[model samples]
Target: MTNHNLYLRLVGDRFEKTASQPFLIIPGRRPLLFSELDRMTGCVAARLLELNVEPGDRVMVQVAKSPESVLVYLACLRIGAIYTPLNPAYTTAEVSYFMTDSKPQLLICQPIERESLFDLSLACKVPHIRTLGSDGDGDLMHGLESLTPEMTVVEREADDLAAILYTSGTTGRSKGAMLTHHNLASNAEVLHSYWHWQDQHDVLLHALPVFHVHGLFVALHCALLGCSTVYFLSRFDTGQVIDRLPDCTVMMGVPTFYTRLLSDARLTPELCSKMRLFISGSAPLLAETHREFEQRSGFQILERYGMTEAGMITSNPYHGDRLAGTVGYALPGVSVRIADNNGNELPRGEIGVLELKGPNVFKGYWQMPEKSAAEFRQGGWFISGDNAIMDQTGRISIVGRAKDLIISGGYNIYPKEIEAVIDTIPGVAESAVVGVPHADFGEAVAAIVVKDGSRQLGEQEIIEPLQGRLARFKQPKRVFFVDELPRNSMGKVQKAELRDTYKESFGSK
Candidate 1:
């Protein structure tokens, strides 16, 4: 039967077309071909069926970077299962919440973390637990051995949930953005055309985490759709990326990656001569960082705007002026407009709430019908919580975030979540979390706390309790003890004042 699965269509069909071509390469490992990937994912897909992971069953994978991780996702897709990926750094407490919410049939973690995750998975009532390491050998693959299973691709609808990516609102609790097969497929196809990629010949440098949409869906989907070869690295390392920069034709990274590259003297134009494009997203890139990278590397970084809800909204022209400080025009087939609180469209150059409607947009927030209803308008336009301004030329620039969430090093760090934990501490009366400018990370989490009476708390004392309570990236980098937090007339904590007051907290360091 012809495969209706999006993965089989985009990846498998293309893999067959380029059967012997090498599609993936790690630093020291042997190059992986399209044919090898087809076989590997097929084996994993058959194993998933044996485990009773039926169509629509969510498979939660929270393992370190590995080839098996990618295979697991493709396997889930081929079988019509919903794939959910969580950050490996998430603590057991964090894992429990996600597990309870998603109620997955299987929970997979790194082999090293199997001991700690055992009790949590049971508590959450997850049926099965599996292990996968960086090299891809684990209980899941071990159990699949010697069993010949069919590779029949399950038929799925366009609206079927492809993946559930967790994002947060002003509140701390995460809301899963249910991305459909159409949502992912259309975005990748649009990006393929917009970027003007050449199949099998274009080389992509991938360093972002597979858990996030930027890496898992956007980067991977684009590569798969274009049949581009990917140099998949575990994480963003300064020396590693720079050493391979000249060999790659395209790279997609956060602002942090570009800033780090600019710091190195070896990031010369000649070194990046082979690179055709460098795309930055996940956080706002400072205009200075954009110019400095261009002066140093002789290439203008293409900045784009996107969210977990909408795969990718707008991008700067690939051949035209790559603007600094502004994410360029809305993507083809996507409608972006500046609007007021009531969703009325505003004139150009006026900063307001940015809303968009397109096939690339997600279905809605998973399981929250009311919330899902509230975020959309009459004609199905989704309210993007970003504050943006549009120029006469239709270029869009973000001014502020209404959610007060911090995007540091390409990860979303919600302040209220951290503040909830801080407020519980004995000496802390109230706390406010804000992201301040940092040269390395686009923004560094800086927290301001007020003490209750004479109790004096050191920075480490305040930071100690948050170690296991929150993810390391969400924790505040620096804590400042203040008399009281600044507030407006409505008694709302004025985060703007706090940001301006501590803008230079990372300055000169």
Candidate 2:
């Protein structure tokens, strides 16, 4: 593992091979080739040295996505410092928890949030603070311009910490998942071949936020390894994605992105004619949306499953059947199995907890030894906490989250199973199911829905479909309609907030 310690250095070696070739292509901005990015990252790395960032020191970056932000990550890697990225959507109070836990050597934030983040940094006693903006005008850029290019690569072992990504923490306080050089490098290498990377010919439609795993690790890692060009859009806009689809070859996104794009009349097969692959992850994709997208675009979506801890677990095969509901098989060099609650492996077709053993799995939760210990089994298998079933051919279909299971009237019910039925209903667009406290049973099932834009969908229309479809215990006891479901930055539904909002729906108070 230590042999490939310099992940960025290896990419730098590739950059040297393709120095003058374009690496990043923004719509209105000047594109940067491999050699230009090299000098820019070197300058940023020198500035990081000026800030006294030591090897293995953590640098918490909560800035908006930009090419300069990419330079910051590369700078950290070039200097062998840990690169910890935070979603710019994080408020000051939310950021305090991460700052307090990670205890980084430096803190970087947006220009507008700098005052608030600086105050928090002082309260937290962090030494250095800097600002970076989406349009590339900030103190960090000024600092970068003043420094001469320092073409030095710090040496780090493979197991040494490279970055710390905080989990979504749906249940409780967020835990930082520590990723090493090996963990990231291994996953990226496997994915390039697994996803059929097009080398210098590939152009990535990078509209996903870079703070999360999907954009930060999987997408960028593949592009950098392949020495590909990235069309780095600031955010995912349906119009922008459609406009750029004709110029790019690969696109990665959550299910929401596809649904929104499918809503527009601009998402025809001709619009995406130049697009070679459409990859989706970060949240579950509804089967209805999947079938509809295939019909509209004349291409099946290649959906993958991963978490903050594990980079890319299972991906639909590049050449084979990209099945509608399955996350396909485990990626090369990754071992995935179904296990009972007691940690015993279950046979295929049996519903149980999923366990994954792979190099892509993180080291552990930051500074939470006891909490981290409970997450892994004896043989290094990390309990995924997802309830899934494997078909005889080794394809994995996630039924629901284990924590999302509703035990009503002493019977086990999975919300995904009910939501799938609700989503396919004629007028329903999407749905989320959560269990809340109840006086009769331990918990009651509730469904929050968003209707298809064509018509107004009522509660009866939603509940009526589940009448014969699901068992009485599995059906939603109460239906709530909303214009949109609450989602995180990565587009996963905020079910914990839903449970909190409806905690008293069944007269718990």
Number of the top-ranking candidate, with TM-score as the measure: 1
TM-score of each: 0.97, 0.81
lDDT of 1 by residue, 223-312 (tens): 888777889999999999998887799999999999888889999999999989999999999999999999999999999999999989
| Candidate that scores best on lDDT | 1
Residue 127, candidate 2: C-alpha displacement in angstroms: 0.2
Writing each residue's lDDT as its tens digit, candidate 2 over 1-509 gives 23455455346666766787778887788887887877888899998898899998999999988889999998898888999998776667668988999999999999998877788899998999999988888888885666788787777888888899986443436689999988998888999999999888889999888887889888998888889888888888889988889989999987767878888888889988888999988666767778999999988999999888988999999999999888989999999999999899999899999999989999999998998999999899999999999999999998777776565543445676678778898888899999887644546789999888877677788888776455465678899988898999999899989999999987743
Clashing pairs in 2: none
Question: Cα deviation in Å at residue 281, candidate 1?
Answer: 0.5
Which 10-residue window in model 2 sums to the lowest lDDT?
Answer: 1-10
Q: At residue 372, give the lDDT of candidate 2.
A: 90
Superposed Cα deviation of residue 302, candidate 2 (Å): 0.2
